[model samples]
Target: MASEELINARHAATAGLIACASAFVYLLARGYQARRTFYRLRQQGMPMPPWNFVLGHLLAVPPIMKTLPEDTQQPDAFEALCRANEKRDADSIIYLDMWPFADPMMVICSPVLAVQACQEHDLPKPPILHAFFNPLAGGANLFTMNGPEWKRSRALFNSGFSASHILEQTSHIVDEAEVYAKILRQHARKGEIFSLDDVTCWYMMDVIGAVTLDSRLHSQQQFNPLASALRRQIRWHVLDNEWNLLIRWNPARPFVQWYNSYQMNSYIAQELDKRYAEWTEDEAATSSRSIIHLALAGYMAQQKDKPRPRMLDAAFRDWATVQIRLFLFAGHDSTSSTICYCFYLLQSHPEAMAKLRAENDVVFGTDITETAKMMREQPHLLNRLPYTTAVIKESLRLFPPASAMRGGQPGIYLQDDKGNRYPTEGTNMWILHSAVQRNPKYWPSAMEFIPERWLAEPGDPLYPVKGGWRPFEHGPRNCLGQTLAMHDVKITLVLTAREFDIKHAYDEWDRLHPTSKVKSVNGERAYQMQSGGAHPADGYPCRISLRKH
Candidate 1:
């Protein structure tokens, strides 16, 4: 009986070994296939960095990262990689192979190529993006949806983001911006440096929260659960650009991710249910007429001749949970970065800063303290500040939070102006907005901060070329929240630009830390880094001083 038991144990151990070996072989085969396909595309004229079959282009990431600080976040590596390779306008498209982790991804540096993929082709978002965003939404939303589902979602949400609607919501936006300005005032009073990014993140939370559902989440003033969860979700998120495999695959990550999702989704779902309850009751229930309520109305319109249900459909409610989550996350991350960079740029360029203030003061009055109140009273007046608008545009062009990332599909290819076709199958597609926007080939003096580029006449050399400046991107699938984002940024700038003189505190931060690496990206101290979405490095530590008028 003992001998029989020993034989059975030996057989089971052998089976486990065999299974492990087979799985290893399968991964090896997949890796080889990726290399073979990537090399074939390279041979066909797609520019790629020197390769390491096992590590793929990840081999190149470290060398570029070494040039900057160690703790710097992702995407800075890819942008640095482009510069290191001396990638030129002619070299419009570059492909990188990242196998056994992520699929191969391509970066389009030329506007012509960007349009081909984003505008003309309108390619679907690759699966990897869905995987990246899964922890946050865990289901289809506007940003990730493609084809029919995307079309339907886009139509439904379009009304909420219409130009007229955004204008109407301007006063609500100012309410939040006023809170943000008050926070800045507190910082000014302390006479100590503070992280503008930190406060901006909170302020944007309240703005979008208020605008979306009339949510009174005063994240700026106090600890807000929804806001905290949103930040955690981004911090916990492992983007493809996060090159650390171990961190990406950490076991602890799932629990935190699941919790954050639950916390945020439940919070948003309650809001939805409350609104739906109001929606169904024709007893003239008080409604916020929020972006979400408008969206819910749109959903009801799609019911056609079906009987008006007493309760929101469970399935639609479930889907709307993820979409609202998308709005909160996307709105907060993208605009926060823009606002920080605008301040950083204006701080650096005193001339442009003066021009911005002049525009604001002339439009809203030199009594800077009263501008926020006046803006709320006559929100339409905010539209009259062209130079202020120019500053925001230039900031976005210089440091776009992110571009539209599309998934490659079978039978689809991107074409350059020369009519050369580049197959996009089996790879993730990116327009690499930073590259296209900052390239001197596309915009003269591109590396410099110039707001006038947006206002240049037809004959000026600094004039923005058609299809070149794509901060919010261009085409059918362009950002749905663009009008609102612009209004949000503009409102914040209007309220704060004249009242406070904000400047980067990187020098002091470096002094205190004493061991930080190279402080600038091509001589600009406030470089874009990955936080939520392309946030400024180290949350843009800066000191705000009340400008003495």
Candidate 2:
């Protein structure tokens, strides 16, 4: 009886403690401490959009139902709302309290301010912004790290992704492209309507897997669960529900993520372990200059001293695995979106397609067999396809794969060039792509598909704006795989244009998904938001046929 009474008493006490903790967290999240931070920033004269108590400016976010028109007064619904809030107020910085208990974000649209944010080494990416992607980095990889660690990781990847290095990997890339070309050719023969988005994704997964990890995922041949999971993971990173405690805390959620992570990490670990063992057995036996080889050699060299570096440890293993996953997550979907959009844009504009085809024919030659042979032997000839490259630039300009974000230092507010002080303390800075790429101030006919703008000579009016275009971003933290990504894109274009002419399979797509409305650009249906990257709404339903010489 005495013991029973003691157990009851303990249970009651524990329940009380949990309740109190819950209340404390609720108060902190429901504008208790966060409200204090808000008022402090407001007191500093920060420009703020009207926000409600809990949801903040979430209500201001335009619904997906509201279509983005090509010739609309507003470029996008978000930008439209920002302009509406800025009526008579000329502040370039807009503040939005996205979460009830979180610090309001400072949305920096001014390019001048953006340049400062990009250039400042002290400014870091906010942890909250990257919480979704932390799993990919295991809390220690390049994308999540800041300061000295970031610099070290960035330097380590530089040599591997350089122009000369990516140039050497062209044969592998071409081989992958050939397999992809054969797949598409098979589809063309059947008069099948296929998803360019899907095929490009498979090809890129194969290329990045081969080049980065020296593993052939064979994504083109069959369904790779790891590739699918990585794609899904990238999409999940941008979801609003990703932060919801109820969903995140659900048992099934972590189980799925853990399973995928385990599978991917295990495969990468096996490869890493095998490579390390082989090199240890005989370093001269493994002389291939793959990215993983170079990285492992560098780590081994660093650890030759007294204290061994963490490169060969569990954390390093996870980090290496995460990077391969990151390449798939970051590289595959993004490049796929870009290539998919390129085909979509070309199909919509026959004139542009003709021009691109003409350029490819002249540079790559009209004979498919000869062209394939030449591409395999002299892959660098891809550099001569300037017009095709311009079309890609235009596609990227219209649809940037990602947006730029940076962290706001504790007390420092960003000041615009015109002496306007914008409060940024305790805030994450978002440089929205719509504001930069589609802003009329930067490019003429911002909503139109104009590849010639990129092709403009120095003294021409259509020349790209000096600081306006940043598809790959511009700074110390620019994409490490920019050259490789562009090369892959260009190679895909060269190979495809040589053999097939792609057209939009609108009829089949519409019949299957009647409820879907494709997003419009310049009064034409073109773009759609899918997962993380923008793709044609109908999964970019494409019909390919052999091009007549």
**Which one wins on TM-score?**
1
lDDT (Cα, tens digit) per residue for candidate 2, span 415-530: 66557767566777877665677767557888889999987998787787665666687888778888888999998888887577888776777787665433454454545454
- Lowest-scoring 10 consecutive residues by lDDT in candidate 1? 83-92
User: Which lDDT values do the candidates have, in the order given?
Assistant: 0.81, 0.71
List, residue by residue over 36-131, the lDDT tens digit for candidate 1.
Answer: 888787677667788765677878876787787654555556666665563443445678886776778887777787877888877877766777
After TM-score superposition, what is the CA distance of residue 413 in candidate 1 from its true location, in Å? 3.1
Q: Provide the TM-score for each candidate, comma-separated.
A: 0.93, 0.89
Residue 10 error, candidate 2, Å = 5.8
Q: Candidate 2 overall Cα lDDT vs. reference?
A: 0.71
Question: What is the number of residue pairs that collide in model 1?
Answer: 1
Q: Candidate 2, TM-score vs. the true structure? A: 0.89
Provide C-alpha RMSD values for all models, in order. 2.4, 3.8
